[model samples]
Target: MSQTRSADRNETGPDRGVLPQRLAGLGAALMVLMPLAMWLANRSAPLTLGLAAALLLAAAAAAGSSREVAARLRRLLATPPGLALAAFLGWALLSILWSHDKAASLRAWGELALPIVFALALAASGRFRPRPTWLRALAFAILLACLLVMVELASGLSQRAALGLGKLMSFVFNRPAITALVLAAPTIHGLWSLPEGRRFDRILAIALALAVAACALRSESASARLGVAVCALCWGLAALWPRLTLTAAGCAFVVAMAMAPVLGIAARDGLPSLILNRFAVMTGQARIDIWLSFGEVARARPLAGAGFGTSATMHRNPVVAEVAPEHRLLLGAGHPHDMPLQAWAETGAVGAGLLVLAGLLLLARLRRLPAREMAPRLALFAAAFAISVVGHGAWQGWWIAVLGAGILWFGPGAARPQGEDHG
Candidate 1:
């Protein structure tokens, strides 16, 4: 049940017209080459964003009839997930009025909004087609990327030097490693679910999973390791009881938003000085101080927040200056480096509550799906959720784009003709 049952019964299918064929080819290329693209990103969000844009446009071209697009969008927006996401986005827009940097808030809101339109359309559109070979190519791509990343890490990043990508640190491969972790879930599930006699595909899936686990354990990125652990756990849990896992994850989001500030304050006060210092060193930031500062800010303005998109410039705002000197280490820190904490800080109770509802609705929409579909998606949610809470900014464009790219396979084309693989 952990496997996603590929519609292998009919590997053969009716012919696709020329335009559809072209779209399938492009989609296949994007799916197969995604891992390499992430590696090439070298931790640059802009490069990742470009890759995500290409995917959205390709999907649009595939399912882009005006009538079809309108129908799909209308249907999606009618669902709880779509409606909740819309409400959250609206709340974000409203926060702009109170934002210290209104222009920046508007820009950030776009980064969050644009990707959803493309993704939701694809998910709701029946015209989009997926290929079996694309899934095969995906596993191979992840395998190839893992081998290459290992080579880079082992050789002191010699390949990076030859590419003229600059003298970036080894942490550059961190994102690629994390990408493989997220991609591995569906890739392995699809491969392992091959028909009864297909031993080769199952073997490949097992090998890919091990390679992904190896990369996560080998990397210096703690977040990547956390993602891998959560992926495995959720993959198993969702297979057995998907509804329970989804409900728990949704409830966790709400509880986390409510208690984030309190936990930060408690940790700062109760944790031993030595333990706090170790945490600071391990995270490579003054994490405790940042947490306390942002925690205090959230506590001070628990309702509407200091306003969206202000986390980056919060140090300059008068509200942050009024906090105690010890909590003032947020200067030029860029972001609080924690997603839920940032949401709690910038959007306050209103934004956080909307986000919690959106998260639950999005996940609940997956209910009653066949076990094959539910497992992979829930596993992916686990990895993404882990990445969100463990690290990264709340509104980073590339992060939003990567999330969009990951869901390309989720829409209504499951029984699509497999002939696209041959076309």
Candidate 2:
């Protein structure tokens, strides 16, 4: 009945043509299938292929949209999030002039362009909004994937080695960073299901949430654990005081910032050494060492970065060698694992600030939504943010694809309430 009503809602309009609608559906379907993509092919292969299909389909839909194509483009670019995205993308492209390796920088631009185009296509697919069922679907998909991860992990300790049989992998079964990136989707979706689902559905959602959280904790990602902790705190605050939602968020952010230093010190001092030691072998510290190295390199060319994708070349510099020669030699030259540092290193302070501004605009957009709608989006954002804070190359293809998927899945259209079916 709910499904029928949703169909009716779309059909009542001037048909929008079957092709465009199907294309939109196809794009959404691909996004929902991302985890499974990771499981089948390489971690990013499915995502890249799926999203590529999605992008092509969405563009076709947009071109076929009854609304004028130019008008849609203007509308998308006019929004705050859109403008911020444009600023960052434009800045990144312009940096090619100053980029140490123009070819690599141009390649980086191509990778960056994928998400930007995907986002625009999604924006243009106006009626293709995220719904409660879509949320349920995404959550269920992630839940199943987490179960698979657990199964892989259960094979045995030797198999559980980082490169072993059942080691902690990202959604793509790649290397581990933080558990939050993969689990955030399901966890947040599960949380959103609690209030609106039937008894069995609620039970299933709760079980999935608990299971995913446990899996994250058991994994080798400190970031995942930290991100989950933040999500839980936010979930608790919202659950306990539904009326003061924004207040709860403000409190959470302020507290998180204040506690970060303290937590860092504690972690370094062996507060959770037994647990921390498990991840030490994963080059968790080595990644941090790389980030520190990036910081030194970023300092030299603070205004315009060494160039997009230039970190590999700059890592051999004396500045980084002087700071942590042993760790530097051990880790080799790689992109900075942290986004802010990556932006600063490649695009400079201006790029970093624009990236942050875009994020803030996205959050502000979420803030405008009704609480029921906002909750999961906020949770997903928190999870993604926490995971990215300490891991992944800023422009890594898979990372960009995953982040882009999240952005479109929970973005503006997704956040809008669609009457009682959604509420």
Candidate 3:
């Protein structure tokens, strides 16, 4: 009777810990809803919603109903990488706080804070299980967000003339590359998590692919499109290439594709000309010029950087000066389009080094995990994160931190034999 009851619980129960499970669902749901809500609220809702959700999760976590859940959280906190990542971010935040530009530093700090806290919360919740149902819920939320954006665009309800929803348009309006990076991680996760046998899963995956394509077409953001392609390629290679050589080759192909613009190669005939003509006026070679300028500045200030958010202060070109009168406002003109460049420009070599080191450590840790167990999901996550870094700028720190937290949460402690949970 006890064995039968255990089987039933494994198949269907409250996921062993109610608070943690609910919080996971809530986190996923919020990720989808917040974008649409931000659009409707004209970008103000996200801050409010984020703060409220954080508070609510904190409250729930403090209730202390489940000793098992609490114990798991304690164990996660004791992990070396988890503790180190948190400490490094905390130190970075402190440095920002002590900087001269308190407001800009505060804003940057806030961006990092949200993801870090969410990651910790998710990790602490002790419901680190990556079940099919949870993945479907997350995917459905993203699809719904995409649909809402399409509706807003089609109905002429958006304030901007862009093809995406009004809320995301705000971010995409300023930094489409970053937005693409943020969206890519979750989309890849959803795609990889989908069950192969389910017709609905296949349909959903196809729909998501089409949605990403349409968003890219409508926005005319090359970086966004590249991000999606890179993510897809990464997932494909990781899922199919159980061997190291094939995976390496696949990775090389993805790297080449991502760097095509820098290599002076066009994705399609006439594409380069079209992009140059469309975005040249706004971004000046669609950020190639800005990236070069940032490199020079970083070379000048190799230690502490020009200081966080100091790119505009160092942008001496007459055209950029006229376009961006203030330093912080320079992001509006076209800040560094590359993540490493942005980090180097703002925080200097030290900051950039720390960031790179963190990434390397993450990759190494993920690689050490049991391939048969977490290889597929870990590969998907790594690929998505890598694409974001290579394709965009500093806008992905939050998502990167979140992905790290999720991996840590569901990693060693949550590992179960492949078919153990199968009923």
Q: 354, model 3: CA deviation in Å?
A: 2.0
- Tens digits of per-residue lDDT, candidate 1, 188-258, equal 77677756536888888889999998887777777888888888888888888877887776677677667
**Cα TM-score per model:** 0.85, 0.75, 0.66
Best-to-worst lDDT order: 1, 2, 3
Please tell me which predicted candidate would have the highest TM-score against the true structure. Answer: 1
Q: Model 2: clashing residue pairs?
A: 179-224
Q: After superposition, how far is residue 24 of candidate 3 from its true place, in Å?
A: 7.0
Please list the residue runs of candidate 3 whose C-alpha ends up more than 4 Å from where it truly belongs after superposition: 1-84, 87-91, 94-100, 128-130, 154-197, 242-286, 312-334, 369-423
The 0-to-1 C-alpha lDDT of every candidate, in the order given, reads: 0.69, 0.59, 0.48
Which portions of model 1 miss their true places by more than 4 Å? 1-16, 43-64, 124-127, 241-244, 269-285, 411-423
Q: What is the Cα-based lDDT of residue 420 in candidate 1?
A: 21
C-alpha-based local distance difference test score of model 2: 0.59
Clashes of 2: 1
| Residues forming the 10-long window of minimal summed lDDT in candidate 2 | 257-266
Pairs that collide, model 3: 39-167
Highest-scoring model, lDDT: 1
| Candidate 1: residue pairs that collide | none
Provide the lDDT at 255 for model 3: 58
